[model samples]
Target: MDLSALKQLGMDDREINLYLALFQLGPSSIRDIASHTGINRGTTYESLKQMAARGLISYAPKGKRRVFRAEDPDKLLLLAEEKKSALEGTIDSLKTNIIPGLHHLKPDFSAGNVRFYEGDDGIETVLKDILATVGQQTDKEYCVFSTKSIRHHLYRPFPNYTLQRIRRKIKVRVIAVGDGGEDAEYSERKWLKTDGPVDASYIAIYPPKVAMISMASENYPVATVLEAPEVARSQQVVFDALWGFL
Candidate 1:
């Protein structure tokens, strides 16, 4: 019998064993249940006590001893419902109270902040931060300068990045430095003609912040994120001018 569902409801192995033992033995004493389940008498008594507290088992005093029986199996469904309700409440609190309060504790980035990241995980972090920061803004849009050489490596760490951005209604404008860039929802693309191969680099200007991704030796990915309004505004200006011409 697959009793794994009981474990999901917070029952340990001992509690499950003792609970099942009660159904088979039918109103048995702790000693009898322990003997039948091959569990120690002390452990069996404690487990049964916990099970009874959870409303999975019921006990009745009989002379000097107590006889225990398993409660209706439907109680497991009730327990799962209770857990689901508690989890929903927690998620609500996290969104409304906990998350905003924690954001208040972050250090001010007005003086400018720069961070470096390496490898696939690092690139993913940069992409996630871009979405998070831009998604909260009223405009919900950003600009990108992407080179053909680096475009494929950019989203390797975050394959679902475009899907997530589209879902959040965040828009992006891309200035393709060379050739070859895909069209995506909530995004616009323009090409910049190049005569020769350019370095593998991609830049994102998302107001108040900029992220640059490049390939190191042997195509190893690296990223730099700068949090400075002036720098971002300057890049935005250049991108806008070029976008107008293209």
Candidate 2:
């Protein structure tokens, strides 16, 4: 079976192997488990001690040898619950303590708050960040300056992004740089008149964050996310002014 999931629950590779070996060998001594798994005796001993500390295993001195036994397999559920509780605590701390401190530090590429990503994967990260930052809220909406070439970049890594957005019931107000993009529900699409060939660029305004992306360089897709309310508001105003013209 895949023990990677168990590893995520905080067990290491040797620990997983030893745990499984203990399960098979029943009440086993360090020597028995080491021989069964081909792990070094010292490492096996240390792992067993760690497992015991985690309450995953137990041992008792029988005559001169200390034999170890795995705890009930059902303890896996307890481990998962504990991890969930710890994660929830961490999330609370992040919202209440960490993020506010980081906000004061700096935000945006030019301002030390901006993160730059290059290549198609980097651009994909920018799009995915939007979805991850916005949780499930029916009225959640975002504004975007969409372009034709954006589709060429996004369709490869995130072919289902639009569909996922629709499913999440997130609304979007888009100003297409050229006469392009299709209409979708819960979205407002307007075209900006252009006389010459438009360079591939997209600016998405989502709350205290604004993401600017350019795909004009073909495979050299780049994006920057700025987390400043004033910047976002200014961009929103510009979008609205352009929006009014369309």
Candidate 3:
């Protein structure tokens, strides 16, 4: 019988063995259950005590000995519901009390919060942050400095990024550093003249934060997010200057 569900309910191998042994042996003493499951009598008794506490098993005095039996399998559903309710309560507490209290301890942006991430998942996180942060802004727009080598890889983790941006009505202005780029709704693109291959790099200038993504050794993607309003404003100024020249 596939008792994998029991494992999901936090039953270890010994507990599972003891539970199963009870089902097979009916109301049995710890010695009988231990012998049936090949677990020592002392360990078997302890496991039964724990399972009984969890309402997974029950025991009765059978003359000088305690005889244990597995409770109805439907009891597993009740156990799962209890776990789910507890988890929901924890989530509510975090949203209502814990997270807000923790936010009070965060350092101010003058220190320039910098975070580094590696791999495609990290890049996706950076992209998601751009959308989320910009989505909340009144302007609903951002700027990008994208190069040909890095442009294709940027959206691999979020293929529908442009579509989502358009759906959210978030506009973007892109200054392409090499040959290729495509136009999309709520987006404008301009190219920079280049004589040789540019290093794979992409920069996003959203107010209060700038995300830089680059290709590292072996073409692995890495990203850095700097949360500094002053730095982002400076980059936006420079991008606007170059944008007008191109």
Expressed as tens digits, the lDDT of each residue in 75-112 for candidate 3 is 99999999999999999999889998986677775444
RMSD of each candidate relative to the true structure: 3.3, 2.8, 4.0
TM-score for each model: 0.79, 0.84, 0.75
Which 10 residues in a row give candidate 1 its minimum summed lDDT?
103-112
Cα deviation in Å at residue 205, candidate 2?
Answer: 2.5
What's the best-to-worst order under TM-score?
2, 1, 3
* Candidate 2 lDDT for residue 78: 96
Flag regions of model 1 displaced more than 4 Å: 110-116, 128-140, 163-169, 207-209, 226-238
Model 3 residue 6 CA deviation in Å: 2.7
List model 2 lDDT by residue over 70-124, tens digit each.
9998899898999999999999999889988886675344556578878778877
Residue pairs with backbone atoms closer than 3 Å in model 1 (clashes): none
lDDT of 1 by residue, 1-246 (tens): 978778889998878778788888899998899899999999888888888899998999999999999998898899999999999999999999999998677676633388999999999999999999999899999999999999888889899999999999999999999999999899999999999999999999998899999999556999899988888999999999999999
* Candidates' C-alpha lDDT: 0.91, 0.84, 0.91
Task: Supply the TM-score for candidate 2.
Answer: 0.84
